[model samples]
Target: FRLAHISDVHLGPLPGVTYRELASKRVVGYVNWQRNRRRHMHDAVIDTIVADLKASQPDHLAVTGDLVNLALDGEIEMARHWLETLGSPDDVSVVP
Candidate 1:
């Protein structure tokens, strides 16, 4: 079976992150994403990646790392929608 592996996608265009939510180390990650990462990241990038991966017609796909930069509710929901396009849960692996 063919297997395609991708990691550290770091999907962004982050959600409405609040100061209260980032009252810890996440504050650092939030700041970094805003200054540096956001410029380099976009949802379309992930769409292109998924398109290419699908074109390859892999028997299985494995995705790793934090799909959302901030792990916000919106981001997690977005990740869920994106994951569906990759194929069924039986054919893809992201979270454990």
Candidate 2:
């Protein structure tokens, strides 16, 4: 059976904030990229990964934590969408 290992995708239309928001432009810039830019490399990467996963027809897929940037409440829905896309819980690892 084929198995796939995927981790830390951090897919987002709005990247999570950081403590350095008060100090780091890079961090803030990332948020802007995620929100305003409309298309990020990360988004493309995710599309490619999901497409590949579907095409590969892996028997199972493993998501090894940190799937999102900050695990914020708002991100849950997006995560669920991806999970649903991948397959059922039996096909992928359960969160809890």
Candidate 3:
């Protein structure tokens, strides 16, 4: 089986609330800052991974934990969209 292994995608091309410019930076919170700052990097990572997967043309794809940084509901959708590029739901399987 031509299997593709991937992990820690953290898909995010969304506009997260930026806190760097805020005067009350202390109130922004760590999670919020990370979410916004990491969005671009995460997005690039996902794009590169997906492109690699497509070029490889694997019969199956596998992903480990941390698929999403914050585990947002929409993150699951983004992951689904990327996985769909492999084939279809019926063709893919996950351990957990």
Candidate 4:
């Protein structure tokens, strides 16, 4: 069977929040996103990857950890949507 394994998708379109929302480790993550992560993490890349994966038509897909960056509720929600776009929970094995 053709199994496609992917990890660290880091789905984008971060939620709107103020500085106070960023607490503890979130502060570091917010800073990183503002400084570097945002630039490198592109929706185009994800779209391309998804299109390629769809074209490949893997029998099963394995998605490892780190689907979100800071684990914020919004990030989690967005990731959920992203996963749905990939496939059903039965078709994709998510480790995150």
lDDT of 4 by residue, 1-96 (tens): 899888888877578866777877888888888788788787888889888987899999999978878888898898988889899888999998
Q: Rank the candidates by lDDT, best first.
A: 4, 1, 2, 3
lDDT of 2 by residue, 5-62 (tens): 7876766765455565425455555565557544643678788987888788899988
Clashing pairs in 2: none
C-alpha RMSD by candidate, in order: 1.4, 4.9, 5.8, 1.2
lDDT of 2 at 17: 52
Model 1 weakest 10-residue run by lDDT: 38-47
Cα miss at 89, model 3 (Å)?
1.3
Name the regions of candidate 4 deviating beyond 4 angstroms: none
Q: Relative to the true structure, how large is the alpha-carbon lDDT of every model?
A: 0.83, 0.68, 0.60, 0.84
Question: Quick one: best TM-score, which candidate?
Answer: 4
Q: Give candidate 2 regions above 4 Å deviation.
A: 15-41, 94-96
Residue 31 error, candidate 2, Å = 6.3
Pairs of residues clashing in candidate 1: none
| Total clashes for model 4 | 0
lDDT of 3 at 25: 43
